[model samples]
Target: MISTVPHNVRGVAASCPQCTSSLGRIWHPDMRIPRGWALAAGLFYLLALAGPFVQISIFGRLQRADIATGPLQLTVQGFDLVGFLVLAVTIIFPGIKLGIVLLTLFGIRLEHQPTRFLKAIFRWYPLIGPWAMVDVYLLGFLVAYTRLTAMATVHLDLSLFALVGLMISMAALDGSLDTGAIWDALDTGPAPRPIDADHRGGHLIGCHCCFLINRAEPGMACTRCDTVLRDRKPDSIVRSWAFVIAAMALYIPANLYPVMLITQLARTTPFTIMGGIVELFAAGLWPLGLLVLLASIAIPLVKLLSMACMLIEAQRPSGRHLLGLTRTYRFVAFIGRWSMIDVFMVSILVALVRFGQFANVQASTGAACFAGVVVITMFAVESFDPRLMWDGAREAAPETPPDPTLIAEPA
Candidate 1:
């Protein structure tokens, strides 16, 4: 097949002779958020808004709450922490995230150069996305509240409506937002995507000035300064081993530590992510059980292993699985923080439930440890640059410099 790429920069270790190109294009307005993410958030917002209106009972009586006046108003009754947590997470954060998405996708419909503000927003995308877990918060709350009111009538109020509204709003936002398309729009360059299609020798090259990713033609000079880049990874394998070791250290306690503390009628159950799933399953709540397992447990472990394998291969500059490895690291780094969902749940719980002797929940040392694990792992993934994988794909030139005297005479 004829080469689509020009002179090979793969042979040059340090420079690129070809001009720089970037993948930038106008994207569809709605194809921004990941699948079902924004919609889910908007849905939960609706649910949370409706939470005040939805009521249950104990004995022959009924009580009620309102979104603005219900648990949120608990602040007046000295429930500061609980009031604050519920307000911020179930209400404030989701609203902010949705607003940002709306502005980015619809308000700023025209794609242009990515300014500093846009890039900053892009980087924090994952962090804001998953915080819209009003439904999860609602589930935990309803479960805990039901157990609490076994002795008394539980009633619904205006707050129920707000909670319902909160849930639906979050759902609408998540469903409508599109993450990949947003990034594509933000790139703002006219160049095609630099991702390699085939493991062709010439299309891959290393920039000597900055060991960054670039493409080169077979036997072509550096795209930057026309320098020859021939060196593969000198110690790629060993370095990946180091990353694996570090990830292993954090993965241990991330599971063992308590992520949530459930207190019901003087009985406290300290539950980690796995413990929560087990408890739910033991209680015959299969759906919630499986959901937690998939979200909290399975995804994190998968991310960890995927990152390790990718970094290891990248460190070696190996030919096999470079693209897959690249993608693996991207996902690992991308999703690492959401693995902290357990921690965030803990944060929400601790803040929302404080009956002060009647009933209260507090974050524990174990939760902190597990939180550390998630954060550290995320940092590790972010720090272990995926760009390094491209290093090995480009072979370095031999040490022998060509002799000037042996140069052929001009024809």
Candidate 2:
């Protein structure tokens, strides 16, 4: 028997404490607030893209960098993949993300509900949201800023200020926007299949995108969002293991080789990931140094080890501390992308510090390797279904017998 719960205008279902499966949010969704923030973000984003991001004066030669300069610089220096990744995350993806939100909100305002086109576009918002990394890019800019000022006379450009505004507006947009509410507003479809009175129990699948709970078979699409309803992610174990292994292999080269080559006065010096961190500390920027150390080095290693442990536990199915493990998985997923900080920093440096033989920064093999590690670990986290751990624990647990004392006697 299938029963679709009516969309609660207030909010979605509360999270399941036992499994850490979130069916809805605690706070109410406010559309008006987020729309304003989105508009602000859009304005800021446009300003950010329109002007020079930063400028450096080295030996009286002026070099100004635009938002696209970093990626182009990296590509010119032969790190095409890294450059593409930077361009996508910083320029392409962020714009796409804002466009999606602004378009959806605009559609909602016009139609007073979601259209078919809006539904299709909104589906990607959650997936693309994480990769639109302006905030993280700002932090990377901070680290890069320290290095730039140390080497030459640096000037913060209009684009830099605009990027700061964009970052803040994006952050605000994220916090105020209730995606569940948006989904609820979009669900103008037919009523769901009625429940069977005789049937009492069935597995409920929650839409990973919209968090819409559906009482349906695994292959069926979600009633609310039309996303495929899977009881669990397909090949969750194997895919996660593959990514983890790949990341683990790349981690070695990522740390061993120099991430960038610093050339000054015709002399080039290679700086490994650790060497960069040490340099930051030596420059008395301990806080920024610590931030980089944790993001670039510690976070990646922790994610790798934590994922390995979780995968092993999922395979074994220990019912112990499942909640803690689930929370840990969430944490791992959240922080996985921050490892890109160093990569962003490198791209910025490579773009701004181009003074021929006087000063130049070139991304090397290790930067690419470390970037691979960060991206692969992120994939590993995404592919590994946390629900699998809970499922394993449930399967391993002993079944409880029903008590006969409560049984009713028939005459």
Give the alpha carbon lDDT tens digit for every residue of 266-301 in model 2.
Answer: 999999999999999999999999999999999999
lDDT of 1 at 337: 47
Query: What is the per-residue lDDT of model 1 for residues 295-383, given as tens digits with 9 covering 90 to 100?
Result: 56776678667766776566455666656676667567556544544544554344445554444556655555554555556555645
- Residue 285, candidate 2: how far off, in angstroms? 0.7
For candidate 1, the per-residue lDDT at 240 reads 48
Model 1 regions more than 4 Å off: 1-250, 260-269, 330-338, 351-359, 396-411
C-alpha TM-score for every candidate: 0.53, 0.91
Output the TM-score of candidate 2. Answer: 0.91
Q: In candidate 1, where is summed lDDT lowest over 10 consecutive residues?
A: 15-24
Query: For model 2, what is the alpha-carbon lDDT of residue 296?
Result: 94
